[model samples]
Target chain A: MSSSAHGGAPTGQGRAAALDPKREVQRFDLHQRLQHGLMASSFITLVVTGWPLTTHGIGSSQSLVELFGGMEATALIHRVAGVCMAVAAIYHVAYLGYLARARRLRFSMLPGPKDAADLVGNLMYFLGRQKHRPKFPRYTYFEKFDYWAVFWGVAIMVGSGLLRWYPDATTSIFPPFVYEIGLHAHADEALLASLAIFVWHFYNVHLRPQIFPMSWVFITGRMTVEELKEEHGAEYDEMMSELERSRPKTPAPAGVPAEAPPAPEDAGGAKP
Target chain B: MRVLPPTGPGFFPLLGGKPRATLILTTLLLAPFGTGHASGPASAPTTAPTAGKAGPLPDGALAADGFTGSEKIAPPDADPLRDARWCRLCHDDDHFESSAWRTTAHTEQVCRDCHSGYHFNPHLPAELGPEAATTNEGATPAKRRAAAWATCQPCHKDAVPEEGIRHGLPEPGKPAAENPPTCRDCHGDPHEVLLSKSLPPVERRRKMNDRCVACHGDAERMKAAGLDDHVPAAYGHSVHGRKLDLGGERAPGCVDCHGSHETKDLKDPEVGRATCGECHEHATPDFVTLGDHRPFTLEARPVSFFTLKFFGWLTFLTIFALSMHVLLDVYRSVRVIMAANRNDDTPGGHA
Candidate 1:
């Protein structure tokens, strides 16, 4: 249900103070936005086109098949979308590898022990069992879960989908049941992924009261300071401390504790 | 062994030599699939379930001109069905066969060709129909139907294969009263067999399936014929059947998977997959697990069975839990929002 899975991952091109120097802070980069865009389009295409053929054995009707003009045409469109998704996945992996090479990648989005504690604490606060909300770091557990789901979902879908697409080649290497398993897994995983995106991701990212309409961080790749403080208070505190050090000769921005002199006109604006 | 079917927009089998080709060519050339089967006198208990269903013709069926090629017999106006007398002068008023004989694939054939058994001279009229009430032929017309059925074996020798006589016609020795149904039951009146050449593949398939449904869909008729009525019910709910019901052009009809001159060679699962693979490329033997209208259960359809259960449960449980989380989050968020709003309204501790 997280809107900004990749958005929370810092680019390391600039720190948060250098990102905007204005009221807004950078949450996602252009690359992250593009990747999300690709994933979103291809995933939607695959689900719409694939659901009919995958569920052809059941309640899937002629209208579904006819929606894409028939089985042959639907199949063709499914293949094209499959290829696009496969490419998008490869592109993501390659980008991650490049980030690792540049030593710019951080493991903040990875799951850690604190995430479980945070989830329990957050739920307690929601249930009025606690006085305060749980403090969140750069990425929440939900965002991490959304990220890893795509990672796992893409692997399973692409692997099983390839096996199904080339059944003759697949069956030659493995048994017929292997192909059948691929078919089963492909269809089931699609349903699971679709549900996760529609219900969980949509609610957290777009439908939740706090993020209703949308979380514009996905589009603008930035969140305002007040929103950053509210949503990711831990990250905001850390960035404010860094901002404090960076502007030792100047004053802190308003709403942040001013521990230094008045600010200079030319701030460290790295064009966030 | 079953004959590997001839593939094309084929009506007759494209089995080896010149004769089969000639037959198909003539059938197609005749612009077959005439709109209406000439109105035979009513009260044949064996007709299709819907009356006048066979009356709906395929496109371009009636061109006023039929086969006039040098290869076959040509009437004066090149219209074989409307040809005058030797036969139609008296037969048109008496029999349903003469009026629409050209709509049938047997358009090239004349009267004595099928009737010559009763007549010694080819040109002489065979004493037939109501006028021949005193003759032995007219006294027992049911005998004439059996004789007419016997005439089909020669030209349509490939149709009644050793493998496929399981459904319609019984053994030759069985009397007319004992016979379950002959060719006319499924194929419409003997004179008009709803020429397949004139129909597009899907319409042809749909019309062919309509005939199958005629006999099989009727539970009472199937039971009377000592056949189970399960097939019609099962097939009607099948993916193929549903597509056909929804007017899909490429949907498999009764004979697409099951062979024509319909029978049950689909017992073998490999054969079943092969039939499915006609349209679905790379259809493994694993795919046809639901063959023969088997229930969609674990035993019959293990993969799909497990897929349904697993995915069904997963979707339900995941959505349910997530929805609960969302609701509690919403209620808590709303409460927090309200509390903050009250404090702001008072500009103090109104909370």
Candidate 2:
């Protein structure tokens, strides 16, 4: 019944105090969180303006058109939103490069034999095929699958959208039919992505019994210490060991005097 | 009453033979007069001849006999088989030979019915000098032949009743103009009334479009009709019309979409949707939810708002999820790489 059991920590300043001895790990920073929020809102605007023209009748299209301030307004908003998505994608790629050069980037989201085993093992556990809990790494097979799907979705939507936006230019390089094909792919893939999010991603992140309301990690970009231990045990162990190794050899060097006594008593005192 | 009889001889003896002669003469004269009066009172009244009734032949009229009549009769000229008597002597067939006369609204009228002054046969041909005939003729010989149709307007003065405004006849007080659309304008030929039923479906359908375009294609006339002035121009450029002009039979002509005999205006709600759907079979309730005939543009609104709204919301939710996924992936990947680098730098760091 603890917050960490659902993969989140309590809010605000109390969050730090709520961290138990087994909890305490950092995942996303402020810049990444800001980019994510902007990208999400822009993508929403793009879908709102674009999808109505694709699936709905003209009457329905008009309201969406009016929402963006008439047909021209809708198109303009969509283009601007597309630019926003592109900027977000560019920032993500740049951020990855920075992380790689700094030796901070991780490949934990990549699929492996262990993830495959986890999938079968978790299915077995759910079906009452096994009595023991399945061992998991920092990212489960589902989480990895979700992560990879986004990259593929973004690549498809953005690539097709850009081609459609500059159709004449695209046709000059490719055939006119190519632009038409791109348009088709763009719309159909968008529909697929939308459905997948509703059925799969939404259920996993928000509607599941373990996380009935929502997973707040997307909003706050933090996880409790107990959450790190239970869901990302291996990562949690590695982080703690690194923290210990990085600690000063002695209590104080003269001027700095070691910030405060190691608060081992506070650790593991509260359930996050 | 006195009984004379045989004893009248006594009275006769007194008056002598003179009295007997006088009585005989008077009786004879009075008997004739009395009989005439009696018959006049018993005889039936005879009715006068009515208008258009057959009357006795005039004195100058030709008789069946070979005697020379008041008017000089020439020997039967021209082919006897094709003589005026061949057709006209029995029936008033002159009216039938005029352009479109038989096909016209006035088909029931007789020759004398309209041409009161012109007598049939033995009459001189309508006098026309070569110069005068040429001056009166139309732009072409065919048009000149069409002039015969004008004879109908004397009785059928108003030809275009459907046209709200009259244009050919002169103003109320002015003299009549020469521009009236004679029977030939619509009926084409008096002798050959084109029966609509006789035409095949394809020709009948094509004629419908032609009839509409006849007036509609004229920019000035269409403007006068209070219709879309750009119709002719726009239709010419449209894919359907252009294809038809290029000889594509499959292309939809005006009547192919609009009905032929039962053509209704585009504004009629019942016909509008059906007309558009005639070609676009996929025009579902969902497809035309916007109503038919929208201008093509980037800002053109769709027909159904609900479906659009649903997709819009769904798309936004999906993109939001995707962004979060990308963020989490970046975070996870960075952490993994950093952990690996640390392990690589330290001896036995993997343990």
Candidate 3:
């Protein structure tokens, strides 16, 4: 295991990993990570400030409200968080437009026919019907679902939240009921989103046995070679082929080896 | 429940629920609680009673410039209920002690219906009768006083202690000081049950508005009870109140909108529509579909409830399915990780 795993893994087709020793694959670009960081911070702020109001006196909500000065202060902080979220959402839209204009727009994160197939394949693997797991691409169906869910969540929450924030103006244009609906939608959706993050998203990204404490991929924006190979093998293969095509153009001038030593033939990439 | 003429405004064949049922059942329920009979226009007020001057002069007498000489007008009837003179025989003419009945809507009602303890003993003169001696067997004066509300509750059954508005009734075994106001505290004395229906409709509404505002207006009381302080004032300034002030006969009063007996908080979503429906029978659906009683908050609308319920179920289902998926995914991932770890630890194994 150590021999084949640490050294260059040579396949039957003679496909080999080229020279990088670190074996670190960039999963998220700086722009995407910054957006994620902003969103995460804004969301946290919102939950901290707004949750006290939502739950009122339940649990530590009262203490939390007191900690933030008073209801008025807490509300002000919530508004600030709301503004932050708005900025992040707007930035994301602008980023999408930039991507479109630059002609580098990729719909890899968008769900497609392959995602459906992958979901079924993954379920089969989970049930032990398939010996090998599905080879995920740059974005799995789960990650796509998260992305779209956020899009939907942000739209509803922001629309309703803004209406609630400016009720006097809202009621002027719309019926009183519209303002009321805004409050309900904003509050209820916030709770649902918060709970989803704490439960489902948290487990997948952090609390799962494999990840345990957390996966630092959001912060580091990189994945280990094994992780890239196992979880996102298809993306890893694409990256490798791209690297192979480009490697000759950027060769070292000195006596450095171009590629690592290949695994022994006896290893055969066999399982225990 | 008012008596519905075969085709009166109060009766609608299309109307549904308790109001319609109450109207239908009025004939059956009317005879027993004689106070609220759905009969014709209520009886006319008789000439104000001029009782024996030997008793303390009624409070209003001092306010009057002078007293007219008592003419020997025959009493209306020998009915014990209607005659304030009967009560004045033993009781003084304080605010509601005896002759004050002449000033209120209850001049037509029997005193015995409300004040159950004091009874007639014909052997003695009406004034010197054993009013105290002939008591309600076991009930103390306070208990009898408290129980007297039982008489009002039969007609105003909606405002029972549990199901009605939060009137701050003391919990059982609590001190009497914590007890909510009895009927008399708000309605004034039973003998002089401050009736406004006999007045002009505008005056009636104004009088009711005042009474409702009395309790709801008390900021300290409302705060102590954890009730909304702005509600009474808000209601007074609402479209209904304004309409009523303009003498809109169809306009709703406090008792009309908030049931006298079974009053709930106006913000209660479940009751808001039905309460509005009592008057705006045709427009109830629209009112309900577009209504939001949380005038203070913009977080709610008629559609809000549906959205909330829908999202609540959606959240539950989504979380449930996702959690299951997560568990399965985790199990598989953990197994893969463990296998990889085992292979890594092995001396002569592969990746």
Interface RMSD, per-candidate values to 1 decimal? 4.6, 15.7, 11.4
Model 3, retained fraction of real contacts? 0.30
Q: How much lDDT does candidate 2 score?
A: 0.47
Kindly report which residue stretches of model 2 are placed more than 4 angstroms away from their true locations once superposed: A1-23, A237-272, B1-351
Residue A202 lDDT in model 1? 83
lDDT of 1 at A172: 49
**Tens-place lDDT digits, model 2, residues B62-157:** 222222222242243311222221123223343444344534544454434434333222222343223222224344433432333335445544
Better of 1 and 3 by lDDT: 1
DockQ for each numbered candidate: 0.22, 0.02, 0.16
Evaluated at residue B134, the lDDT of candidate 3 is 23
Pairwise TM-score winner, candidates 2 and 3: 3
Tell me which of candidates 1 and 3 scores higher on TM-score: 1
TM-score of 1: 0.63
Ranking by TM-score: 1, 3, 2
For model 3, the stretches where C-alpha displacement exceeds 4 angstroms are: A1-21, A57-59, A247-272, B1-302, B334-351
For residue A68, what is the lDDT in candidate 1? 81
* C-alpha RMSD by candidate, in order: 14.2, 26.6, 19.7
